[model samples]
Target: MSPVEEVLDFLIVGAGISGIGMAVHLTRDCPGKRYAILDRRDQLGGTWDLFRYPGIRSDSDMHTLGFSFAPWKHEKSIADAPAILEYLNSITDEYGLRPNMRFGLKVVSADWDSAAARWTVVTEDKDGKQGRVLTRFLFLGAGYYDYDEPYDANFPGRKDFKGQVIHPQFWPDNLDYQGKKVVVIGSGATAVTIVPAMAKSGAGHVTMLQRTPTWMVSRPAKDRFANTLRKFLPEKVAYAITRAKNIFLQDLTFKRARSAPDKVKDFLEKQLKEHLGPQYNAADFTPPYNPWEQRLCLVPDADFFEAIKAGQASIVTDHIEKFDKTGIQLKSGQHLDADIIVTATGLKLAMAGKIAVAVDGAPVDFSQHYYYRNCMFSNVPNLISVFGYVNASWTLRVDIVGEFVTRLVKQLDAIHAQVAIPVLAKEDEPEAEDIFADFSSGYFQRSKHILPRNAPSLPWRINQEYRKDRLDMRQAPLDDGILQFRRVRETVDA
Candidate 1:
């Protein structure tokens, strides 16, 4: 019953992959160091727990998806949702992580007390009981997928002619589409995945509606040679080869699209045409820019095409004008009838929603900050938001950050320092016009002004390249002007 034992050394928010990964690392490396993982859900695996949509799977292969220390032992590169969840559960059990987790505990806010040199966390349990925890440091492993569907298509409709209207994120458990016509709105990953599965389940008809075209690159879920190599050679070697190959192809296609214009894209369209046949046009599905600008949605084993070929699904390249009682009215003077309307219109980006830091008890407005190295927020003291690569497996970058964080924590202990904060100079902040012109979608754009900017941007500054990150995050001096450190606090027992 010691008060000090009650206070943990570190408080990690979210028990998902990142949170669980951080816990495993800290516990294994530091040993007996007090740390607790808080998650809002009743169970572990944030997205894996929340998303129960059909055909849900990882975009990247399992080789790079799993932790560096843990290799995914599966024959196929792309795995289904249940298998992924099981894999995560096994890790949780193997590491004995459940005991360290505070489930159904949602963190309302985190405030850093400068004088105490500690973080004060306020949490509300599922039963509405409020409790507080104090910790020496805080790490946010809360991922981007926390929020549900941002905008439910509230189209003008007659409530009188109702059939079920569902979003894939919150799909109905008793929803039966057998021999029923279905229309999935949006061309993103969610919609693409849903259409095929619905078709396979004996749905009479399924159609996907897209407002804008997206780059849909369909490939086999399993690569034979790579899988065989993984069996014979070491897992790491096989993973490295697969990762390198994917990276090379991604970069090559991106460079060709950006530098060589429509030539390469046209070639891709020709291939698409050959596969999709005469009635189906590829241009309706091709993207405006090069690949990797925005992440390309991965259809498992080109299942979307298979659905189309089987006459189970089709695509409508038009906007929905309004909703009738039974179906939707498109702007192109077309009426599409359906018994179920599934809106999979992508996600709304939120930048570090779980993190709310205050200095000396004043709330720090993170949106005004610039990102430094895309890891640490500018002018924010003792905080880092870990984001991964767009081209490769996200976990790869996360694992690197985990290692780096451990190293940094160890460094602070060695130096007798209490705080490590990112310090951004006024001169480093890019102008408004420059920022608006350059920044893209998702987390990057959401944190644009506050994040660190590279001069002569684009090809030079984009953090997609791993070597630059290694230089900035690993090789850079700790005492550099970018981050400031402060001394540890001592309390008198007199």
Candidate 2:
């Protein structure tokens, strides 16, 4: 057994964007605080590092997605995956964050001991060696996306397929598909990206398989107004304006679309029918669900449409019956010949995987947990977690979370407090009418019971209105709770 180490003030799990963002604020805002960040992976940039599929780019506009303090200096607002990864790496390097980071260390469990006023943390290193450490606070920066394995859809006769079968999340690097026919399954961003990329790379034919059509919109990689502003004014000023504009427009459109469905349907129908042509009616491409039910797809340069127009790619609106030796057999009795199949199914989220936190020695299952301000679990002490939206940039929420924590911690310290936890009752009880987050994903579904069901208020809810979030985040009360204060002498054993 590795010897027990000195207790940490703050112990962060996951060294990805969430982890880095939180740590930066903690270190900078609170001086002389001993904090450590642990990550299972060897490198940083969690999702960005894991996914290496072709033609990957930001679905949300970059201005809203990037860190508010660190304005994105890139000419193109819609950055590719590699570029985003590089940006994350640069932040780590610039901040000298490598020293506090323990790579290849995975936390097995964390139990909160109320009597001792500390958390007992168990971690396994890369070599399966165990180590123990006590920490005052636990901040979960582990993202909502599941990293274990891809969600593989089981079609009949999948084993009989002779060609290469790849999931966009796990594409084999060595395999080349220069002159092969490719069939991409699912209609999400990954599938949309793969089709255009494969077609351009000399794939004889690329087919996009979708069970239902999603709302896809085309926008420039770099907006002219944003570009001009960035060039002339300061990056922060330009970013502020761009972020505000996108947030307002998205909220406005989504609100109008939800309230008045007919207008949205008609507008979207006319746009899709114009591009897809008369053969396939607008109803075929239009979704059965309401607009913004899921995040609308954003395409740069209208590449998906261009690929279809060029006859290199075709859309198959049929449920997959089974996979044959050469290709897939559709439910409509049509079999398309293919040398490769790519499943671009959505992600699976795991909340605080393996890190079990207990209150007063009783195991605390955070699944189906309540989210106070969408950051803290109800009645949970010295712990808070942040998850961003599917619509706007993740960094936007993460930054706000970091700022709030730092300010709250400082406020606690000022009052000679040992523990600082949120008080749900003190902060107005959330009404059923205020529950705002709308995600049908399995992760959200599994844990929604415990999460704060608010209809979307100011800081606690995801308003996506930049002006509102900015005001709330920058000017909200950091200490609204009855923070339990413990004197060191009271806990000391004789």
Candidate 3:
């Protein structure tokens, strides 16, 4: 190792849920892996630290969103950002993950030299200072979202608008909209959450401006069944039961929604009517597309509708023609006056965490390869990327990925191997399938072309099923004949 370079067995990137979970798993499972985690930000919490928008909370239940090793003791299943951040911090502190993590260093590039059987990772810190780390294995556990660049919809006349415009990705502090009219644009979870939160937080009134309706489901903020189970069983046992129950029920609900869209749609709209009142416009709540085609916005305890019933917030289904000096003007000839406008538009999908990868000094293109087992990309030597499901809690898939990676690391060590690469021979390459074909969300559509397309069959299919993935990653054999193992040759000293 050079004065500036440090060598490690594993280099994990992005100190978020996945990275933290990876650290915990490595410490417990692969005891002496000699790993290091690198994060670009000063803090460890990845998305929680990045998104400071009002009413920031989990769309999934906490029982499943929380790490598998850690049972969510709190009753609030749909937790807010601060509570979530605290949970992550607790995990980091408990596992002693802080000492192994070098903060403020963002991975800029990673190059694999076949002869050395190690990756040369180049990173730039917050200070614009460059550093290097050489490691035998590289794990990309960075949160899927691109922190530096937000998805821009290129709203017409955005420059002409006079009122302060804010994006949920980088929400500013001391942003005073108290007792002032607010308009939040977008139909996703962020818009729904902000509309209700701002209303209750003393905004004069808030309107959700949407071009199309999003599927909204009202679920309990607390997990009653899980809490009851915990009362009778031990922590791990109770967590297991709740986790299994929630996963089955959520997956069953998803399958049912996919099979019977009309029934699910009617039930959801009926629920909305019950909360919003008898005269509530079901058309405003009805989405043209089926549920699960795009992820449904989960409104905990119908709080969003409660805000509307209390005359604090409203929903406007109209296309914005342009942003005038005061507010947004609709193409439907209606104008919405606003003191503040929030573009909860969405984020750009970045599969590789924006880090450049090269092999033998040649830049690697992710689009050219297929994702093997939804974790490892084809021909990506000694690398595993953790990108989670769109329909379920991110931690569900992340936890599974962590366990699988640990198994791989141990297997490599057992075989005296320095590198384990996914090699796709001619027969192994299957037909490409557009995995994001059904997802019509703006974010998915924005960068759909850049995402790695998977094969239609096993080992390459992009799985959204949590139980299936758990079985596949946890119980499956590490030697699937697809992974090629290599070891560095010992050179005799002259």
Candidate 4:
């Protein structure tokens, strides 16, 4: 084993919401533990910092999205990237977590040593300088999508286009599109956001061209109930109440969509009619799939519909034949001329932040293992990866997982166990199921082979139900029969 300066109790990768939340939990629950947060980016805010396209905002309400320990006092529940980043920064400063953060470091690989019961994590900085850190536990909060690459749809003859072709993931700051025709490809959240934003922000006309329509709903930017409650109650008290309310509503809506998709579809149709009125194009708005199959796009204040009604934006549903010199050629023989093309095509999902993981010199294939309680994997010792809920606010799962991790670490110390692993016997292995079977998102579907296998039941599966997961993860036995605990020989004194 290589000599290290100091061993960290927890080495958290990615200083995003998940990583920050975990650090805050460690500070409060595992106060004696030594931890450090490492992020590839120089700045903290993960998704919020990475994405800089116009109209970039939280699809989920801030009441639930914000950290449970921190109250989101913003007037708008659906906030932009700047506001979200500010909230995250405040949390970092308030918790005194800045000193423990190491930015501009990308984790390359992690190898666990059974005898030592520690992981040797390899990291590389921007200048290609390598560094190593020895940690007892490794937590991955690096998010699911690939940071270096966006999904490539590979539209034919993209090179032929003369106009500015851009992907929302990498938007250029100097590019000007005022009084110019804009075409946004894809019907996802990014596309919806860019269409309205470009339209409202001086684009002569903005057209959203999608191969297939996506489900969308509109609501007010600010939460009336939450804003009202803040006036009478304390900030934390109001946040808690609002958080609970939003979680319940989110769960209920998901359940209803799955149980009675037809009714939910009708409700969405009604909303579209109300928002777009005469401008409503059923063929362009109505999706062939059921609600919640893919994420339901949330448009704050009907801005998207208003843009279309105001003649600044339009929707074109057709397959792209190819890209031409001036614009895109559609299969319907329609040519949409554009000075700017924004490809909002979805992200490319990457598991474990594409970090090479090995256990005892053997490569670990995540697909072969079962997800143990959504936080840890089967047969993987001293590792926790936070993959949030698809249907609810991501931070809802983050808060519960944070609580569970703190509890697990405490139990390990109490039992004098140096290593804890979820061991699944060959015969006892449950039937394999897609972790995100319910979700039909392109990214989720594409990454099925790389993701860890899920089971039909609890503890072996990644439960989407936050209410159940919160209870199970928090109160469930730490020394469950599946998880094996052992004490390794002490190599160094703390």
Candidate 5:
């Protein structure tokens, strides 16, 4: 039997970091607002729940990645997947957010009614059952990547390869890879992580084969300053101090890389040479592109390098001509023999799970519209979708966004406003460019076509700076002239 429809003040999508973070804010800041969260996955932690490959961890430090309101008390800033998931669960338990979450519900479509000033959402479950939800506001936290479909790259001769092929997105839970030769293709964060992880997992040989090199660097796993501060000062004070320092350092590094790519690149290579020593190949870490052009792969505590030094794993730079019966054959006439191949290539990006949208029964094409305030869409009422920073910690922007959303919701309620929509002036040009214009990552480039148009200035530009977005999203006025507020009358049958 279909479940009875229930109405809410807000309907949050996905149970990931963004969804959980936003829900906590709404509970504390907007007590009067009622909401429900729906996630397609069966678990509470979205990314952490989905990715179960060995040695999975955050690329950014937890000080910034963790929630702003609730501090991460762990000594390790670079935490493993399990620890991060535990922390998420702990927060959910603390705030009683688990019960409000509905698992195995994939959102299909959401229709906004001008007459009713509410959203009617359609969702389907794992058992092929359908459900409906009504909400005044729709918050999309489903993330950008599609969980069901990883980026499918048809590398030549994939079908004829004798060895088993695996993609990190759909890792087999029980596939025994122990004492077998493994080749992980790709040089991104995923490849770097799995190469060392698989090597430690009893793989006789683990080779990371890449066509091009990606910049990689390492940092200590634990934060001594943050740990010491926690012992003496209050939790909040210590967390704030730690978070601020990390943010400042990260921003300065990125800025310097952008401003002086040659100098930064030389320094990075020097540090890498010191770690790898003597046999260190500069060509393996050095790329044709400048630093900050793509995200620098982070190896915590030099784990990847240690694995290499210990003769557990290796990196090979070459273009793959095809997958042969034995292994991958490179264009340079070199062949890598492997018992298993792991394609950690990349992900397929989709916004809000590509849910069909309509405003008063008229289909809304995201490409035709412009993003307002980096979160809301132009002419889209009571809707906010989070697209975090590429250069800094994702949750930093997420934290600011969560606060902004609840504040906006509260202000609407204060004025008895039924619908709050952002309206871009006709004079405003839809620049048709990305908010992160200079990011040259393959994943970002691949999704550009499907991304929505964006404007270029304040309150609209998707600024990547943590310091600027911190104040802009948190301290900015809610009643900007751009947002049109109204109390639409509900239709009554005579």
Candidate 6:
């Protein structure tokens, strides 16, 4: 170890919503601790800054998506990318966190030293310059998806027809699609968002081509209740009430979908009928899986349906045979001629932000280890990875995780402990289950092997229920028997 190297009390990865939220907690609760935030991108907003695709907006309401410490005062609950980014920027300004942020730095790997009770983190810059940071605690808020690559469907004969093939992840700037035919592949949120955007923005015609149907629900862009409350109450109070109401509705809907799928399906069908009217096709809208099995795509203000009704956008369900010079040829003997093709297939999931992790020179395989408290992994000391809920807003989990991590840090100081780890005894090891088995999304299914093990019960599993997790993480004892704390004396060389 270099004598001049500075060791931080906390080193947070990723400058996205999760990382920003974590930073807020550290500033408020552990004010005396030294910490910094780093991200691979040049900008702070992770997903919001990366993708420049049109009609990009939050699927969940801003009341739930915004940080707990901040109040989203915008009229639109389902805000566009710019509004969300502005909100994040405001938080940084209000909390004075900008000085501690380091951009264009990617975490390459992290190795924990038991003797020092600190993590030596390796990082790389945009120019391939290597750097290292020492931190007593490592917090990973980099998110769960692969930032460099999106899931590739690898359509046959891609080089032959291509006018301009694009993935939503890497959207080309100022690409002209006006008065030209556009075909967007996949039926997920990206595709749904892009189809209406392109069609309404001046594409001669847009068609959503999908192999399978995805469950979709539409609500107004603005929240009337939230807006009314804001007029009469303080901004923070109104935000709190709005956030609580949305949380309850979200949880209730998810529970209803699980308990009575048929009823949920019928309700969705009714909503679709109201939105699409004469253009509604039962076969096209109906999905094979139950509602909430995969995330239900949110269509704000029925824009997608409006585009369809106006003869600007359409949906085609079929298998792709291959791509021709003009467009895609469907297995059903139909050809889609297009000037632009958008592949909104899906994202590729990753673990630990693709950072190679090791403990005492032994590499850590996250799949073999069990998740403890949905934040830390078994036997991993002084490290916490923030993974959000699939059914609810991602920020909901972020808030609870931030609170829990802050409390844990304070507890370590109170006990004068150098390291804290969750250790599972051989006799107490629970049956291993797929962490995201309940969600049948393609991304989750594709990356199951790389994820950590989850059990059926709490403290050993990653729970999706935000309400229960919030209570347990905030109220639960940090000195539980499973989590062993130790004091280590630093060894100095003579």
lDDT of 1 by residue, 36-116 (tens): 998888988877777887777787777667777766777777877777778888888888888989888787777777776
Put down candidate 3 lDDT per residue, 364-430, tens digits, no spaces: 8887788877788888798888878888888888888888888888888889887788788767578
Error of 3 at 131 (Å): 0.7
Worst 10 residues of 1 by lDDT: 432-441
Candidate 1 Cα lDDT to native: 0.71
| Alpha-carbon TM-score of each model against the true structure | 0.89, 0.90, 0.97, 0.98, 0.97, 0.98
Report model 4's TM-score to 2 decimal places. 0.98
Off by over 4 Å in 6: 1-5, 491-494
Task: Locate the minimum summed-lDDT window of 10 residues in model 5.
Answer: 485-494
Ranking by lDDT: 4, 6, 5, 3, 2, 1
Model 6's number of clashes is 1
Give residue 76's lDDT in candidate 6 (0 to 100). 100
- Of the candidates numbered 2 and 6, which has the greater lDDT value? 6
Task: State the weakest 10-residue window (summed lDDT) of model 2.
Answer: 485-494
Whole-model lDDT, candidate 4?
0.92
Model 3 clash pairs are none
**Candidate 2 structure quality by residue, lDDT tens digits, 1-494:** 56566488889888888899988898789878888988988988887877788888888877777776667778888889888888788888877788989888888888877767777788998789989878878888888766776565668898999998888777778668888899998887788888998898788889998888877777788878888998789878988888778778776777787789788877877766666564444534677776777777777887887788788988888888889999999999999899999878666656675467787778776542345555776567888787776556777778888887888778767877767665456355554432335544333555455444443454334455444565676786665443344444344221
lDDT of each: 0.71, 0.75, 0.86, 0.92, 0.86, 0.92
Candidate RMSDs in Å, in order, are 3.5, 3.2, 2.0, 1.2, 1.9, 1.6
Positional deviation of 105 in candidate 3, in angstroms? 0.8
Model 1, position 125, has a per-residue lDDT of 78
